[model samples]
Target: MSTIFLAVGLVLVVEGLAYALAPSFIRRMAEELPKLADEYLRIFGVAALAVGVGLVYLAQHL
Candidate 1:
């Protein structure tokens, strides 16, 4: 339980830093997302989904 909480807390801290310090970068990325080719976009989406799933699995295991 403590491990899970630590994992979630770490994720939140990193995300919060991004939100606080790189809002423009995030916005730019979002704006540019649609300009990516369909295949590349699909690949990026899949990779992100996989990473997210892996993180959740690790958190659970921890």
Candidate 2:
């Protein structure tokens, strides 16, 4: 659907902007990620997923 494509495009745009504007920060995050614990990363992933789902739900209903 067009909505799906738009969402993907927006995500890519934001990701690109981060790398473009803060290349050093992005590299630092990538370097630090390998040192992060698996459990911590898992929790972060879950939190991000929850936030994303909540946003989509609100976008559709509101």
Candidate 3:
């Protein structure tokens, strides 16, 4: 649908801007991710994945 296309396009735009403006910060975050404790990292990853799935479900229904 047009709305889905627009949403995807906006996401790409924002992501591109972030990469252009803060590439080093992004890399630093990635590099430091492994330093996080396993349990805490797993919890954070699972919560983020769950939230992403919930957003997709809501987008489809709405």
Candidate 4:
């Protein structure tokens, strides 16, 4: 659907800006990611997923 494409496009734009505007910073974060524990990354991923879903719910209902 158009909504799904819009969401994907927005995500790509934000992701592109991070790399384009701060390539060095992005590389540094990528380098440090392997140093993080799996559990720590997993928890943060889950938290991000929850927040994203909550936002979509709010957008639809409110």
The true-versus-predicted C-alpha distance at residue 26 of model 1, in Å, is 2.0
Model 2, 24: alpha-carbon shift in Å? 0.3
> Comparing 1 and 3 by TM-score, which wins?
3
Name the candidate that leads on TM-score: 2
Runs of candidate 3 exceeding 4 Å displacement: 1-17
Q: Give the per-residue lDDT of model 3 (tens digit) for 1-62.
A: 99779878988998999999999999999999989999999999999889877988898899
**How do all models score by TM-score?**
0.60, 0.94, 0.63, 0.89
What TM value does model 3 have? 0.63
Check candidate 3 and list the clashing pairs: none
Clashing pairs in 1: none
Q: Give the alpha carbon lDDT tens digit for every residue of 1-62 in model 2.
A: 99999899989999999999999999999999999999999999999999999999999999
- The weakest ten consecutive residues by lDDT in model 4 span 51-60
Compared with the true structure, what per-residue lDDT tens digits does model 1 show for residues 1-62? 98679878988999999989999999999999888899998998899989988978986799
How big is the positional error of residue 4 in model 2, measured in Å on the Cα after superposition? Answer: 1.0
> lDDT tens string, model 4, 1-62?
99999899988999999999999999999999999999999999999999999999998999
- The lDDT values for all models are 0.90, 0.97, 0.91, 0.97
lDDT (Cα) of model 1 = 0.90
Give the CA lDDT, 0 to 100, for residue 29 in model 3.
91
RMSD (CA, Å), candidate 1 to true, equals 3.8
